[model samples]
Target: MRADVGRVAEALVEALPQPYGRWSIAVFDDPTPNAFALPGGKIGVHAGMLAVVRTPDQLAAVIAHEIGHVLADHSNERLTQELAVQGGLMLVDLFADEPGIRRLAVVASSRDIDV
Candidate 1:
């Protein structure tokens, strides 16, 4: 974690409306301009984004935006939706005796997205 990012994470967590857990910031070496946050306070910022972001405030904006997604419970909603869909399919398989349905369920359950 970069010192600057560590500071930003601290400030952001402090500013957050509710209590948050330990957060980690990771700066990737890749050149693509991108950033995302995952559950449990894991934040990843692409190295390329640093070139265009220009200031700590801009970077903070990006971090805060990602954190907003976590705060909104988008990830949990998606997981619930996926599970419902997969469960339906698995139920159908129970009647049809299709082994492939279990494989599909595994794949679906493993799917995830960064916020």
Candidate 2:
């Protein structure tokens, strides 16, 4: 864990709307450059990121962006959207009057949806 990571993360949490848990920041010794902030306030960094990000400000920027995702609940929003689509397709599969429409719904929902 780095001082700048803790300092920026603590500062950002103070302005968050609700109470957040104690934050944990840790580093993984990997060759990939990436970082993530989980729902429970656990944040991880790949050691290789230091080579790519260069400055403390750059690292802070990455952490802030990931924190924004957790704060906004973007993951749940995406899951809800998928569930709604699946439910709509299920309803069509059960109740649609036209066989063609039902088949289309089934085929659409079964396809590999790359989001």
Candidate 3:
């Protein structure tokens, strides 16, 4: 499994070069059919995933998908978006006493509109 992951990773790196750090693959003994990739080229695969995947190519596809997420910096993007939303909510709460802003917030929340 390690060799297979290494080969697929090497091919992917050659195909889509990035300034990512060293790639490391870890297999967990969990029964859940899951896998994930973190920033900086860290990948993890659950043992049950092998049972669910029938072919090496399928495994490669899974690994590639996870790698794509890391390459795109999805985690950081999600974090930034969440922080921005939280900050906006905090600002709205802080200014809830102001008449205009409070009315806007009430209308936006009641109608599920983005404000």
Candidate 4:
């Protein structure tokens, strides 16, 4: 299993332009059909995913997709967005005691709005 993953990963890495991170792939014992790639080139594949993918090419495609996410920095971008949201919520909480602000927050919350 490791050999097959390595072969496909090598091919994909070779096709990319120079200066990608140092990659490492690990097979997890989990039953969920999932795989993920982290920043700095850590790839994880669950045993269930290996069972579901019928061929080497399919596995390569999955791995390549995860690698694309890492290369694009989607995780960091998502974290930044979440943090901004949390900060906004904190500001709302801090100002919740003021009459006008409290009224607005009450209305917003009644309407299922976080702000």
Candidate 5:
């Protein structure tokens, strides 16, 4: 099982256009058909997803898209946006006692988590 993971990781790395810093991959035993990539090239691919990807080339496509998300710094941007929204809400809560501000802040807070 570990050997299969290593092979997939190697193939995925080789397919990338350039080296990604500290690249690593893990295969989860979970049956969820999902994969994700984090900053600094860490990735997780569920065994269920391996079953869904019938070919090495297909797997490479999936991994490449996930890596692209990481390379583009989407995760960090999302985090920064979330923090800013939270900070704004805190300020609104502390300084303004208006009902409309509370409602507006609630709406903003709800949408912010989607980032």
Candidate 6:
């Protein structure tokens, strides 16, 4: 991650409300044209996104969109909904023992569902 990107992330986090201290951001070196924010305020931006985003505002738009989902508690809702629909309440506790569950949740939630 570039120092400037890190600074931008820090600034964005500072501008957020309430659970500000829980947030973190990272820039991945991959060239995949993607970015995502995980639950608990983890954000990841891909190198390809940086290359194509064109301006700080555009980049901010991408980051802000991800942050919006986090702020909206979409993942938690999705998890709960998925559990109910799948009748996976018995397996819900598995998330506590599975790091992969959290990672998958973040990735799934970060996807642009509207697209």
Candidate 2 off by > 4 Å:
1-3, 14-19, 81-115
lDDT of 4 by residue, 1-115 (tens): 5459888987888888876868888889999999987789888999989989989989998998888877887668657765665676678778665667645544554423111
Clashes of each: 0, 0, 0, 0, 0, 0
What's the residue-level lDDT of 57 in candidate 5? 69
Off by over 4 Å in 5: 1-5, 15-18, 84-115
Compared with the true structure, what per-residue lDDT tens digits does model 3 show for residues 3-60?
Answer: 5766776777677755577777788889899888777888888888877888778988
Give the per-residue Cα lDDT of candidate 4 at 113.
Answer: 19
lDDT (C-alpha) at residue 1 in model 3: 57
Per-candidate TM vs. native?
0.65, 0.58, 0.65, 0.71, 0.63, 0.64
Please report the TM-score between candidate 4 and the true structure. 0.71
Sort every candidate by TM-score, greatest first: 4, 3, 1, 6, 5, 2
TM-score of 2: 0.58
Instruction: List the RMSD of every prediction in angstroms.
Output: 5.3, 6.7, 7.7, 7.7, 4.7, 8.0
Q: What TM-score quantifies how close candidate 3 is to the native fold?
A: 0.65
Error of 5 at 95 (Å): 14
Tens digits of per-residue lDDT for model 5 on 44-68?
Answer: 8889888888777677777777777
Relative to the unseen true structure, what is the Cα RMSD of model 1? Answer: 5.3
List model 1 lDDT by residue over 17-69, tens digit each: 78877777889998998887777778888888877787889878888887876
**Residue pairs in candidate 1 whose N, alpha carbon or C atoms collide under 3 angstroms:** none
How many backbone clashes can be found in candidate 2? 0
Candidate ordering by lDDT (highest first): 4, 1, 5, 3, 6, 2
Return the clash pairs for model 4, or none: none
lDDT of each: 0.77, 0.71, 0.73, 0.77, 0.76, 0.72
Residue pairs that clash (backbone atoms under 3 angstroms), model 3:
none
Work out candidate 3's RMSD over C-alphas: 7.7
